[model samples]
Target: MTSSELWSRATAERYDAEESENSSAAAVEPALAFLAELAGDGRALEFAIGTGRVGVPLRARGVPVVGIELSEHMAAVLRRKADEETLPVVLGDMATTVVPGTFTLVYLVYNTIANLLTQDEQVQCFRNAARHLAPGGRFVVELGVPPLRVLPPGQVAVPFYVSDHHLGFDTFDLVEQTLVSHHFTRDGEDGRYRRGSCRQRYAWPAELDLMARIAGLELEERVADWHRSPFTGESTQHVSVWRGPSPARP
Candidate 1:
């Protein structure tokens, strides 16, 4: 199956339930904190705002959030969790969607950049983001470092964790950069388990910065985490902030 179809099915079935609790709290809280500080009484835009994991909580903090999401299923999920339709979400790909109005903050989270498989598509995403930002407005992205080079050839199983009753296995196809995970719960009744997978391309931080430059945005900051720690070599995730070029400069 195609990558997009695979992701649509996987997210619709098991991803929400698996990530809704502790994982969401750990990941989204820091992101929200950073967003809150950056926005500071201004409007914000969220690209690929899947399932409202971050958008819902951020909205509660009194920020007017507009979202661009590609999957209808994921958008529906976000709509259900929102209070009084607080967030206005447009159903379209982030790479080309034209969201109305300019914003002080435009953000994307959770390695969503990889959703654009080709370099041209990724560049388009940056341009689209720039189009929606007011001068000096910031565009923030949270993505992880690519781990493909470290893996051995023909190695499908990379164990995330293993306990007496459960085994979390992450399997990947190197050429396509697709990941399939199977969790086996042993203590439960026979065959009581969940299987899900997603396909995403990986891009380096430097590459993303160049794309931002091509879109007339300049890198303003790179932080290790949402708390604004300095980014270092050991950092696994990146929080890169970019600013739109001033109108008079160009």
Candidate 2:
């Protein structure tokens, strides 16, 4: 039901290995700490919880965590690491799926929102996050800033990583506000490179703030990273938190 691209079984099977860097303790700890602090004494929900990368650990850290994932293939990989009761995940669209309880923290990390590919869908995602939040709860999103500055007057592509075995770049379409990331990884023994590409819609921080406002949430904090570094023009990525309105009391 989601307009986002579905990750295939092949992609899901290789996800954990290919994304080892993100799964490293260095990357997960700080983010887990940040989330755990927000989820204090309350439940946490993750959008697109691929292979339980963060959810399983967050749950282990004494937080109740649940997930909504679009791909059964990806969810299947996660199921292997944790049982259903430990980290329950519903298979559905993050923008429209309704999981049964409220959450103090609802988070979407690693530029996953860009997968929605349309402004309306992205906006709906914010609304969905709001819908799942308890009063005064927070919705967090981790996203990369559009790298348009790196694009020259005529150039439309930017290389993010280049290595002897792996090469990665992103090509942009300014008119559509979209980008497609291309990756090529070489098989050590075979000497053949495998290629993959994913298309996503990129959004600016101001635009995301507006979407949060439209969803009846207020911007609470925005930082350069999970470490709480200050966000500036030079920052390439951001972690933003929006707070839902508190209940009215007489």
- Model number with the top TM-score: 2
Error of 2 at 53 (Å): 0.9
Task: Please give the lDDT score at residue 205 for candidate 1.
Answer: 89
Q: Which stretches of candidate 1 lie over 4 Å from their true place?
A: 1-10, 22-26, 83-85, 152-191, 247-250
lDDT of 1 by residue, 69-95 (tens): 888788877787884368999988888
Clashing pairs in 1: none
The weakest ten consecutive residues by lDDT in model 2 span 183-192
> If scored against the real structure, what TM-score would every candidate get?
0.83, 0.98
For candidate 1, the lDDT comes to: 0.79
Residue 136, model 2, lDDT: 95
* lDDT score, candidate 2, position 31: 96
Q: Candidate 2 residues 224-250, lDDT tens each?
A: 999999999999999999999987787
* Runs with alpha carbons beyond 4 Å of true place in candidate 2: none
